[model samples]
Target chain A: MTELSELHEAPAPSHAGLDVGNVDELHEAITAQDKTRIRELLDLDLEHPAELADRLEQLSHSDRKTLAELCPDVFSPALLAELEDDVVEDVLPLLSSRQISRAMEELESDDAVQLFEELSDEAREEVLEELPEQERREIEESLSFDEETAGRLMQREFVAAPEFWTVGQTIDHMREQGERGGDNLPEKFFDVYVIDAHFHPIGYVPLSTLMRSQRGTLLRDLMDTNLTVITPDMDQEDVAYLFEKYDLISAPVVDADGRLTGMITVDDMVEVIQEENTEDMLALAGVSEAGLVDTVADTVKARAPWLFVNLLTAMLASSVISLFQNEISQLVALAVLMPIVASMGGNTGTQALTVAI
Target chain B: MTELSELHEAPAPSHAGLDVGNVDELHEAITAQDKTRIRELLDLDLEHPAELADRLEQLSHSDRKTLAELCPDVFSPALLAELEDDVVEDVLPLLSSRQISRAMEELESDDAVQLFEELSDEAREEVLEELPEQERREIEESLSFDEETAGRLMQREFVAAPEFWTVGQTIDHMREQGERGGDNLPEKFFDVYVIDAHFHPIGYVPLSTLMRSQRGTLLRDLMDTNLTVITPDMDQEDVAYLFEKYDLISAPVVDADGRLTGMITVDDMVEVIQEENTEDMLALAGVSEAGLVDTVADTVKARAPWLFVNLLTAMLASSVISLFQNEISQLVALAVLMPIVASMGGNTGTQALTVAI
Candidate 1:
């Protein structure tokens, strides 16, 4: 399949991936109300089944209503794992509380934590009450991590073998583990952390190196010593930079006690990069935040403060114009040209800021 | 091989494909030269091979110095493509005339035209004289297109097939033609333009579509009728929007006669998106232009005029302060809070302007 087609058909779990086909199809489906075709497409067994499930979930509520209620079972946990927080929130309410609890149970600690974060306080409490005791503890424990830190971002599902294992054994273990029934595992991962007997991550083996190397290579011998251990408390931006600078696909996030907690993957980092880029662009523009996906009232509420501040600045500029009113009256050219100069200056300054920032 | 590794070693032709590895390696290499890496990375790659070729050919005797002789081939075509017009003028003379001619031949016509536009009268004549007649004619013809139009930005090298061709035949044709080798073939293309007997582009098939489709499918059957055609006179900004709005990988660029002349691809659009974004950012910041690779001098040059304009604006704001100077003399608190209000408003205004822009 073409990358574009794959991109469209198989939505990446992360909000970062652009499904051009889904976007187009969704647009068409919404306008035309092609519910039958949508249902057919939804039922089709797909290679990236999780992605397809998410796409179906993301379809308009009106569209989703047309599907049989039993269809929710077809929604994969990975699809739930891939959705945006706001999107998941919207979808969660549509599902039976049992389904919501099950999805939460199926999620890795970080994903469950995020899903919990997006819930209404009452719904969250209800969901927390419904979750199995072990699941609830994991969610609550992850919640203790600072927001927008590695702790919050990393997925708790990870493969780490003891340092004594041979590369062959590690691979075999992972393969054997796969044969056992597990409902949800990351469809892709890039590294295996080598841990001490006590579960302290000592080093890492990039999957690429592991795949190419001899099976008999000891995990300890093969692991990269110059490894980056992300502390749970470290900021997500710093995490992004480390990933970017080191070309890390996935890195282990450790607690203060040096215990491996979870892993942060490149796909997540890609979203962070795009989010950060949007933030920089918006911030440089003077927007308060990026992705103001809340209701229009919230968006306007967030946006208006900046506008009000701008009004004052504009008034300041206006006062400058008012000061030169006499000068402008005497030489209207100054008034006409003054704006040109200011406009050009604003443009130029923005350009400089664009590069510098 | 992983996409990241391929990206690392691919010799990225444009900044559009610049992966983290290149930036990191370049950062390290610059630091290894016993220079502050950040400062060095911030500067233009002026002595880049393609630029050096352009420079040695264009510079007058005595202006060429030891620095000019120490140029490196590692300097990229992309770097030269991004040089400021003024900087291009200053450096092109250091290049060998033959090298200049060869580099021009190697560059996309749009880039060659852009470089040609920056040359001095004497240098332009000398360089043009050295170029192959057909190549020179093509560049000159491209120059005839309005600046910042699709005609100027479009790559002439593209794959087009008659609508009657089956998928197998089209693939065979491309493979055979690639073996034969000629200028008409795009170095890389995202689509195959399907043309009618009259050579008017009827539809397009993304290379991915072409690769995935059944061999017996006719080109006409596979082609997407939802085509976004670019007229030579169309503005580049409008062109950028079409690519973005349609999620187009590539589209046919037509001449005044409505006949296909070239194709514009997403990679090119990606550069345009970045450039336009940079332009918007710089404009908002009151800077003239924020070319990422600008030298300190070039930066200062882009910035100074805006800074001067800002000085005048500041003075205008200062005059407001002066109006309140007497008030300030009476109450120092007025001065302090006055800055607060102005500062707050400035920040607010920037926020609004950023969103608007």
Candidate 2:
């Protein structure tokens, strides 16, 4: 196991988690303009991008700008993928169009699309111009879909095998493909879809099943046909529900004619589930913190609408109580009863509403 | 594509989801004692066990009791694993000790442990006596851990290989082991642990990576050492956070000696995330509906405590309002302001609490 002290040279390819303690130390290093210490603390090859992204998110605004300026390597492509969208929006202006496009090329398709989406319109045009034609088309085609739909979420890169291929043939193809490290093969995948002439997935086979089966077994015979097929336009939440309900490792995303166009994997579905849950929680609380990213003004704007609605209702409630002002003046006990009853009723309503959501 | 009508003979191996309409039809079929129809509605071959479990969950208690009596096979082992804990508690009593032991034998180790935990002490003794010695021991060992720790959540069955083995050798071993249909090979897995002599995972090879590697490539060279190792004693929520943060498909669970014991998969983490999120939501609402399974009484017992607490606090507020009774008597406007102030303040507090949570 790699110790925390040796993080900059750690063997882990990526660290998706970070400790807050690391951030405090990084802050001091940035403030002192210790470029050597910054590089030692954040090696491009060894450290997890998430560790850096988290550190940057917690930094003071000027510290972040200074760090990015002092150590441009700090905003590695992987770090761009892991950074929160708000932070990404803030950081993109610091990079050149070539730098941004190079980052897009280095990342997987879904991440590349996300990074592309963060650019300002003028920057998007410049970055898109700098990207390879193939890379540029993938980003543009993915962006054509409605946001939060399966089309937007699916990676154009996936593994698909014809039904005629045997396990041995499929393995040979994958080995050849993996060597090339092309856009067609996903960075990591669990299942191989068995497609028909029209590119529809007739069935799918988990890699584990393919591995343990006889090499001579046809992909068709080895395949499990009970796939929960997802259409491109399906809502991401619905996509997530299918993944959860089926214990799916990955599902094929298809076109109108039912041809497999792309695939959505479980790792992405994990995020959608959390997002939907947070949305549910926020909805129940009557707030909409969904897009409130950077400014304190944004936070206030997000939180204020619900309070304003609450105030309007509160005023309505006050009017109802005022109708009984005569009775309250005659008996002080009536006034005491009003607050108790109102408060208890409000709490009970909140409890019921929470469960309903 | 498998249309909605092809459900009974559907090629899909499992459905972890259910349609409410299907549950309603199952209810009608049960009332008529139409065993053929019931079986057609829930063919163990093509249907998802969750579909049946959901049906049982929604049935009236009397309908459920009668359905179990009329169709004993409705409680399939897969359905036993898929069932919500409350529904399992209700259905377990209807099964013979022999039947329960059989279900435990059929299910994966983690699910077998969950089913065992749902049994009454008397029933557990009977079921344990009926189980095979190894199965009985596995359940007992799993039960020794805290309810929501990694030990309780992980499946004891996993695939691990020595680092010295080549890809071909590892593949051959897996094929031979998978052919045996034993407890040690998980039904599905994505990664093969490359472990030391003592069974500590030093690295892991994603099955896809194995598929793409040349047959003669050594497992040691092909493996990724960026493992996010989990301990048996870790809280399941913490385990889930690591999965979401690190985008892990499966993580090896280790014991005190840092030797791999079991593995937790993403499917289980999905449930943990939802469970934690729900718990968080309910806690925010000042309620605990955690164990309120079957009865209306159970619901009241769960929700009343929070409301009672609200009543006590509201009474304190009422006393404070009474202290201002003389002021309110002079100005009716002061009384009107109280409800408006109390309501808006409560809403703001609720919003802040929601965010803090």
Best by lDDT: 2
lDDT of 2 by residue, B1-357 (tens): 433222122122234344567888888998899988988887777666666666677777778788778887778888888888888888889888888899889888998998999999999999999988988888888999998988999998889999999999999998887678635578889999888887778889999889877889999999887777887777888888778867899988877767788999999999888889999999999888655245788888889998988898999988988888898787777888788888888888888887776
Please provide, for model 2 over A20-120, each residue's C-alpha lDDT reduced to its tens digit, 9 standing for 90 to 100. 57777888899999999888777666555665676688776788889878987778898998888888988998888888999999888888988888899
Candidate 1 per-residue lDDT over residues A1-357, each given as its tens digit: 121222222112234234557656754654566666555555544424444644654466655554425366645565666666666777776666677788777766666777778777778878888888977887887888888877888887887889889967876676555446433344345567888766777777765355445567798887775566777777787776655444455788766666777888655665565456567778766566634336667667777776676667666766655554444444433433443355455556555456677
Chain A TM-score compared with the true chain A, each model in order? 0.80, 0.91
TM-score of each: 0.53, 0.93
- lDDT (tens digit, per residue) of candidate 1 on B1-357: 121221112121243223455455443544345334533543443222333333332323333332345433322455456554655666677666666667677777767777778777788888889999988888888888888878888878778889999977876676556456535566555577888766777777765355344567799887776566777777786776555434355678776556778877655554555466657766776677644445689778877886676667766766555554444444443332443355555566777676665
**Residue range with the least summed lDDT across 10 consecutive positions in model 2 chain B:** B4-13
Per-residue lDDT value at A356 in model 2: 80
Best by DockQ: 2
